[model samples]
Target: MKNFAYTRAGSLSAAAEAASAEGADIIAGGTTMVDLMKIGVRNPDALVDISGLSELEGHEIGADRIRLGALARMSTVADDPDVIAAFPALSESLWKAASPQLRNAATLGGNILQRTRCPYFRDTAYSQCNKRNPGSGCAALDGGETTLHAIFGGSEACVAMYPGDLAATLVAFDATVATRGPGGTRTIPFAELHVLPGDTPEIETVLEPGEIVTAIELPVVPAMRASHYLKARDRESYAFAAASAAVGLEMDGDTVRDVRIGLGGVAAVPWRATAAEDSLRGSPLTEATAREAGRIAFADAQPLEGSAYKIALGADVVAGALLQAKSRMGGE
Candidate 1:
């Protein structure tokens, strides 16, 4: 890694201000940032450590809404009694993510802001990645193996997927991301925090230059307790998702009353499957119906050579997650 000056910030505002300066960045868990720095993908001259900022450290797992501190470790949130009881999908997403060691070290905010795991983008040896170098070209699309590339919300310039599990579950529940920037503190819908990989593939999120995420808030809802997260990967442990789904449903006599579905490992952003929700809402819950809903979720997915199989795998995973969620509705 490059030699960088580090200063621990006393407050979130101070950290934000320091990070606003040129060649400065914020370090939370140091899992993602440090890895990128070591790989030469990111080289910040100065790093403002926000791990000690008290304002960004606690959880409010209340009856009305759950507020998760940005600096809260993934393992802490996953083990919280209220989180496990109220938001199974949220807890499951974290538990099924990276290994236990990583979960203990990684913070909630850092996980959401994690960079793509695309080989071309990570390895500086490849010179054709547009996300790493804007307008350069995408090697993955040009005869490069793209089994893990995005099929939805991807432009020709970039096909890399947003490799995170927590954000997918948060998006499914319509969580709000609270941030403090130069202007002031504000809350934005979690869905809007991540941008689609359009022409500007390099710009990943809606967070302004000086903005620092403070917390994530999710409203307590009846459906959330019955939610479940299912991931399909090549290996059982320490493997990225090949296709994953976070599903929550409110059922009325075997019929769906309301539903929320978020798809991961298949898109540029944490994909909220609105069409799938539309298909399931107010409809009888069955294998056939769930499969149809899954198909609707990927109606707009444009797959490349190696990723074409993901379309079918993603649909099956969605269907399975819906069934799993429905089975858990009895407890709620």
Candidate 2:
């Protein structure tokens, strides 16, 4: 809603150069950025419209990885034959996000970079939100039931979950994010993109001020076809998840070979379940094993006062997702 200067970038350097000024922000689809600005949470003196840079578009599925240009549209990736056949979890995750209209305009990079939807984080109507204004104190504690708050990797200062549907799937797939910045281009594991709100909840990602997202890369996942992403939200449409899981499995007959699990809605980040995957690897794909894997995923979860239900819900989400993924694998 605030008046601001806007300019398009010709290339990656141009984008970074345009965004180098203090209080400057990049606009891809302008979905989350514009929303944050409307709430007065973001006040960019200049808006670098990177949407015009065709250099940051398209994807290439190579022998070992899929290179995703930062500007590749969500709808385009969701419908790609290779992504559909191989990275079913990635494709399903995108299609299951926002509305079709939103997906049409939303880029893969933008989807992963979307901000948390915590009431305290997004509501400018509220006077105190540590995320919007650090050290202001979180009102969700005494004000209302914060059932949607994070359960993992939260400090006493903040408990807002990192909210994005596609991001969870990307982390599970071991995706890497490429960025071009003031220093030079750098690659970071997608799982390392988000930083916990230890003291500063205002800063979400590790990208430098002048760093522009270039691409996201996913290494080959042979078990990707035997994958699934499921969300238990308030409704079947136009909603964020309440509890969700992204799962992929490789098997030798009924014996699990490799398993990857990632959870959303319960963590400050898209939480990769190393314990659950370890429990399932080299084990028989039975209901009991699946249940154990799910439970192990939440063994270290620390829930808030009013949101203990997430531990059980998160476990069930992982279990259900594993079962569904195995069923699909059986069919294959």
Q: What is the TM-score of each candidate against the true structure?
A: 0.98, 0.96
lDDT of 2 at 292: 90
Question: Which candidate leads in lDDT?
Answer: 1
Each model's lDDT comes to 0.91, 0.86
Query: By TM-score, how accurate is candidate 1?
Result: 0.98
- For 1-332, candidate 2 gives per-residue lDDT tens digits of 77889888878897898798897989999878888898887888899989988978998888788899999998898889988888788888888888998989988888888888888777787767888888888877656558888889887778888878888798888999999998899999989999998888778889988898889998896778799998888889879888789999989877888888988888888789998999998889888888898899999988877778888888888999999999887632
Which runs in model 2 stand beyond 4 Å of their true positions? none
- Residues 1-332, model 1: lDDT tens digits: 88999999887778888888889988999999989999999999999999998778888878889899999999999988888888899999998899999999999999999999889999999999999999999999899989999998889789999999998899989899999987789999999999988889999999887789999999988889889999999998878898999999888887799898999999999999998999888889888998999899988899998999889999999999998888886622
Angstrom error at residue 30, model 2: 1.1
Give residue 157's error in model 1 in angstroms. 0.8
